[model samples]
Target: MAEQHAAGAEGIHPTNDPGTPGGSVDPQSGADSAAPTRRARRGGSRKSQKATGGWGAVREIAIVVVLALLIAFVAKTFLIRGYYIPSGSMEQTLELDDRIFVNVLGARTGHIDRGDIVVFDDTQGWLPEAPAARTNPVRQGLEFVGLLPDSSQQALVKRVIGVGGDHVTCCDASGKVSVNGKALDEPYLYPGAAPSDFPFDVTVPEGKFFVLGDHRNASADSRYHIETGTQFVSEQDVVGTAFVTAWPLDRFRFLHNPEDVFADVPAPARP
Candidate 1:
């Protein structure tokens, strides 16, 4: 009976350790299993960081682009704007399809003087209908931001010949246009082109301007609109003065106002 009790005690106190080789559990196996899980977690964290970094770069680029567009919009609206010349009306000074920069501030301040080349809106029915052209939203947006030339259909460019209350007439004995009795020495006229092909005599009304094109013979400017009572463009319709030729790099130059041409003329006679 004592021998049986001794055997039972030995069975209850078995000496094989669980973590040893050939035992039920191996500590090294558990460590190896856990190592794969840890590697998988590390790889997932790296991928997540990479994705986040890519998105951050895209967001920064978007912000920079938006800021640049906003600055261009403001400059085009109030400070300076570009215009595309569609006709040869102001030839020898500005050519067809030439891009020009206009000073909006000068026009707004009423700094426009005689002999200055100006762009004006066709408030009256002075301009003929324009031919159709293809356009898309993308092009329109570029034009609005001043990245492209202005595409306004009713804009005209001309030289100021007379201001408010000034007497303007064509064809003196020397075949020259006269302003306030002083014949103008117009060197800017197209070669061999007369100041005017026909005779005209009129007094510029208050707050209006008498304008003519440098290419007088080819241009149907104020003269053509005289019979329709749209002879003069109002000061309010002036957009700005073309101060610089921007495109066709070879022909680029600052536009001079030719103040000497109007130096001898007197101011408008007030009633």
Candidate 2:
């Protein structure tokens, strides 16, 4: 209290008021009385402004973060989504544990082309029923917002061999798979793996697709589901087209459809 009073006193300026009966001055110290209350109010106001500014900055940062997350979620839901390869079924093309970005819009008719890898839901019990995934809240939240790939999804990635109304068969005269009478010289197949270990010939029904894995021998794709007669995967069940190998920086690369492999093949005949 003593120090504050002395400090205020030292800051006082000498003044004389004409309205006073006699502009009397203090004999010891000549100065106007210091307004300590006003000074203290100004000091408190500065501190309050500083605190409000800090909170405002924080609020702005929070809004930006929320907007970014919303954009990611929208993209994941309708434009693109991320997934992690969990099996060797697509080996050599998509290695096990590789992360990939899938184009959700590409699942539409005519967008998904032959030789393009795709991710699809296992709708018809293609995959054995597994218990619900148990994940931590943090990791689950990240996946929900598209910051992390959802590796727990019950989905499969395979190459599109034939789409809607096309004839797809395995082991042509040259032991290669054929679509619409053109043999596929698949260089993406797993090393030492045949085009297909089993033979199958079928015309994909309208709005359905015949898919196979790059590692032919090890994959139980459309061919392995024949016993149920639901060998063809419906177009409606496709999640998206896997268009990149995204994880393990050393393996980062855009996934392109082997269009050249299907270019020479004629389109399916329309009835």
Best candidate, lDDT-wise?
1
lDDT of 2 by residue, 9-122 (tens): 775433464432212345577542334445676899999999999999999999999999999888988899888888999889999999999999878644877887989888
**How does residue 94 of candidate 2 score in lDDT?**
91
- Candidate 1: residue 67 Cα off by (Å): 1.8
RMSD of candidates 1 onward, in order: 10.5, 5.4
TM-score of each: 0.80, 0.83
Model 2 vs truth, CA RMSD: 5.4
* C-alpha lDDT values of all predictions: 0.84, 0.84
Off by over 4 Å in 1: 1-26, 29-45, 149-152
**Inter-residue clash pairs, candidate 1:** none
